[model samples]
Target chain A: MIDPVLHAWGWEIPVYLFLGGMVAGFMIISGYFTLKGHHKHSDFSSFYLPHISLFFLSAGMFALFLDLEYKVHVWRFYTTFKFTSPMSWGAWILLVVYPMLLLNTLVSIPKSFRNRISIFDRISDVINRYPALVKNIGAANMVVGAVLGMYTGVLLSALAARPLWNSAMLWILFLTSGLSSAAALVHLISPDKTEREVSAKADNGFLIFELLVIVLFLVGLVTSTRAHKQAADLLLTGPYAPVFWGFVILAGIVLPLIIQLLAVNHKIRHTPVAPLFVIAGGLLLRFVIVAAGQASVIP
Target chain B: MSSRYAMVIDTAKCVGCMDCVVACKTENNVPEGYNRDWIVQDVRGTWPTLHMEIRSERCNQCDEPPCVETCPTGASHVHDRGGVVLVTKELCVGCKACIAACPYDARFIHPDGYADKCTFCIHRVEQGLDPACVAVCPTRCMTFGDINDPNSQVAKLLTSRKWHTLKAEAGTKPSVYYLT
Candidate 1:
């Protein structure tokens, strides 16, 4: 007795996927920043990281709010928490991550100091008292982000109504796609100097992973039972043919591969635009997959 | 006024004329190309061994309705009487959280863009009339009554017959029961 409402396409799911992809990218960017010794770099964390994270986080929250049937009910999601639901997990993550990113930003401000001591230092001292709380919050956020990154695929796979999406690979594909999109996004958004170099390598690594995942995904689509096969055929040669081949395969995957190849050959650094293309391609792939999965008939 | 109304359906008697579907639409003034309630035929297995089952499902008007709980705007709500789950389209911002939470796809957004679903013809029921679906059914497949009343037809039937509801796994505790 799957809900009919879940079957249809609304704008919000794609929007969430897009934002989720970006967030994944930001996580990698933050990781890169930490690894590259940029954690101590003055302008990197102080000016750029906080503002960018806030901008995306706020926009993600806005998109989340817009996806709900009852927008006001979202407030209680935080106030009255449910530890069981994935949505609750996502809500708790946003709750901690948004504030931490913001506070981490504010504390970096030189003016936010008590004499030689920064306000963040004071805030950290207070939070450090609740060591369990801080650890739980970080753990919850990473778990939530990881889950949220892959749940979009699960949303489709949960439907027994759609055979093509019912595969176990759905989650893996989603995870890889999300990681690829995220890496590409970081490449697009970060400063063009050192961060760009860090993201470039990450992008290359993820692109290889994306390609492998796509191959496995295609193999599963082709080798499944008759119902799934027909559904896959619909995407391959039926009404959704052009969208499946054109947007998803060509522009989204191939074009970026070509751009990256050219960048490597020219001895020129990959521009932010190259990675942005990959992110856009990933988003387009999710969109097409979602829509096509719905349009597929069970015959 | 603390009255919870629900329908008990006899699936064996239902020929699937879909009178309930049409009746629900007309009575609710359901928008064109949208249904408040519908009969879905679940066909499973391959040829020569295929099985077909018809379920006339709408809002089950659950005792613990997830749609009501998950709604961020309180647009989707339950009526105190009959436990009818009603959506206030006027209040709905159309975020679709209710859609995802509902294990039964009893709710749909009409083309005009508001949440729409079967109301059990509350207006007529308020006037002491049977819902349009029950009244119009030639085979009397649908039985409407207050399950709380010992004398009600629903209560008697529940005691005597084997019954089931769609997606009992959802734990929605649907008021609509099916005696197949």
Candidate 2:
């Protein structure tokens, strides 16, 4: 039986977290490509990815809205911003994100598409008039993307009630995972050989960092107080172990890492399967963390 | 000086009859399948020499409430009169951040899509009366009053007896105290 006291947050949360992290990941990569001029080589990197990132982010926000019991009262979140509250920070961040993503998407549209769409032509003309503005937007995307990535983890870590979530390593772990997942997504979609190689290499690096951060997170929890140790046990030897090991570790990180490495080195052909695993792993990581965190209450 | 309202529960006197639980439910009109207060039985030691401690649990109304800190809106705030942690339903988006942040597991999602928890019977206390739980407890095990007032029963009990708060290490500095 599910413990009543320990099951307040349900399935919706992990889904929200996963989507939020994915958006951040995609934004960071898209921003990086735009800034570094990789967009010049691949039209997919410049245009499609940023729009896709915004789409996913909007979907994620919708999921978050659905989770709210008082959906009509959501305006209250904007009435006053509390510096101490992570939720408040997240709300404001999301507010900034929508407009920023829209701006990026507008500027990245190809001239051919802009010619066909008069509104896009006018918007692109204005944006193209100032080269520095485009660069500034790209930089803003990178910064905002990083904050959005870290915020997902910080949101959970801020909750002191759940020992499993109160880890300093969580934010780093989440950011790296976002980066890896984003890279994997870009690698899967980009037709350019150089672009795919770069993203694949980056994903491999991010996966390594994510693995270390996960280990450190567990170490910190296990070496802490009794409650924290119990929280660690939830993932280590408790009911969640199988999912954590099978899905999050093996399938999500290790298997994806191996596949990506083989693909990068030309030992194996790059298939859609590796990126798919990375995305699934990213979603599952959020799911396991959120579910187990709720279960690891101070009973 | 303003009152800092608190509860001093004498666990030794409690029989776990759940009078307070029923009273709180009825008084607050808390939804079914949800609660504002309950009882916890902590069983210790081997079977032959086993001992069980039955304690009544409710919102601690923490001085440094994590729930308040985590709330996106100011829906969860400490009342100016007595520092009572209360939720303003109209402002609550029911994001469940406070529910996750509370160590005591005191808060619940009200059916109306707002967070709900113990209010220290603020309505009754405003009229200089005890909370419903304290008034109905058969053992008279609960003392509710201003902890800042030395003359108050809660203050007197706290000063004279050795007591502890649940999850003291949580750093919440809860207003509720339990006498062992």
Candidate 3:
């Protein structure tokens, strides 16, 4: 039966997308600093970010697991890989993410944080000996990070059945959103002033790009076809408008971006407000998009 | 010859009797409040100039099935016999990606933890019988056969009638057609 309302997904997917996006941001940030040889001023990028990302990634995986109806059949995802299926790609990416996160910690580990575990310390000592391999690992982080970020949106966009998520621009929007979120978290939690300033500045830039992508996403939808126009309306004037405009645009990106821009210019003292808002906004964006996408019908 | 099964439904002949719906439900043991097939009554224009189309709809069983392409575990697949879409429960992870990918709104997450939908009664078709819905259609409006066989009724109907597939713009190349 063809019905007007869609109802296949719920909160778990949005939460998972949000966490996955943040994890991607951390990897990109860490990779950037490690490759640039400026990790000394931003230990958060190399060391803490990976650990935090691991925690978040694990939680995100747990959320995905919870969303699965046949919990025991979860292993079926690994049995065969479908190139056209985003879930298959995501599963393999997630499996490799663990090693990448672990390898990242050992590459440029701070001494004070080392020797806590005998096995880890020995492995870290052995791995740190190879500078070239370590740098390659850093590069891998960025590449894998980027793929993971885009895959979250690609997962939705590949479903041509849902017009709202069918855009080619969705992956770019999600990737940018993920990078911005990672930068915001680093800005908020990093101890080093240089790291804070660098990440805050980057966050501001990403936030600006995210806003642009969001605008372009709707425009792309509205201008295409009738079903697509209806999808755009779901966010513009439909039920999802308030959360999209109020939380994602106003509170999430615009306000945080404004605060960070001021702080970057030394117009105001740095505070936790902006970064927190950015992170929350990133989460809200996923929820609203997923919900609205589900609500959009082909008719 | 390779068989490409298709269903040709005459909208002009169908009276919205719902016999097909009930037959499919009982034949498939579909759970309550869920259906493997259903009726849609679409009325256009005002009361003085009304044009009504009553369609008994189910899965389109498309040639380029999104459900098959999007299934991570190879659970949703096309039958080797006639390109009929079927979901194998043994490998299904119950992710509902198929449900989201189906533009027809045909699939549902089965309570037993797998994606479920109208299979066109593949078992019955395999046993050399008409599908329950087609067999029981009161007006004899539904014709099911291999469209690849030019001699088949379905193929003949398609040639003689002015018919259209739903959501043709979706590029699914649906197997079902509605004859005007």
Q: Residue by residue across B34-130, what tens digits does model 3's lDDT show?
A: 7778889988999899999999889999999999999999999999988899999999999989989998999887778888888989999999999
Ranking by lDDT: 3, 2, 1
The B-chain TM-score of model 1 reads 0.90
Model 2 Cα lDDT, one tens digit per residue, B100-149:
99998888888888998889999999998899999999999999888999
Error of 1 at B48 (Å): 15
TM-score of every model versus the real structure: 0.68, 0.96, 0.97
Chain A only: TM-score per candidate = 0.75, 0.94, 0.96
DockQ-wise, the better of 1 and 3 is 3
Fnat (0 to 1) per candidate: 0.16, 0.64, 0.60
Each prediction's total of clashing residue pairs, residues at least 3 apart in sequence or on different chains, is 15, 0, 0
Summarize candidate 2's per-residue lDDT along A16-120 as a digit string, tens digits.
788888778877877777777665566676677778887888888888898898999989999999988998999999988888787777766875666787887
Could you tell me the TM-score of chain A in candidate 3?
A: 0.96
Residue-by-residue lDDT tens digits, candidate 3, A233-297: 99999999999999999999999888889999999999999999999999999999899888777
**Model 2's lDDT to the true fold?**
0.87
Q: Candidate 2, what DockQ?
A: 0.61
Give the fraction of true interface contacts kept by model 2.
Answer: 0.64
lDDT of 2 at B32: 76
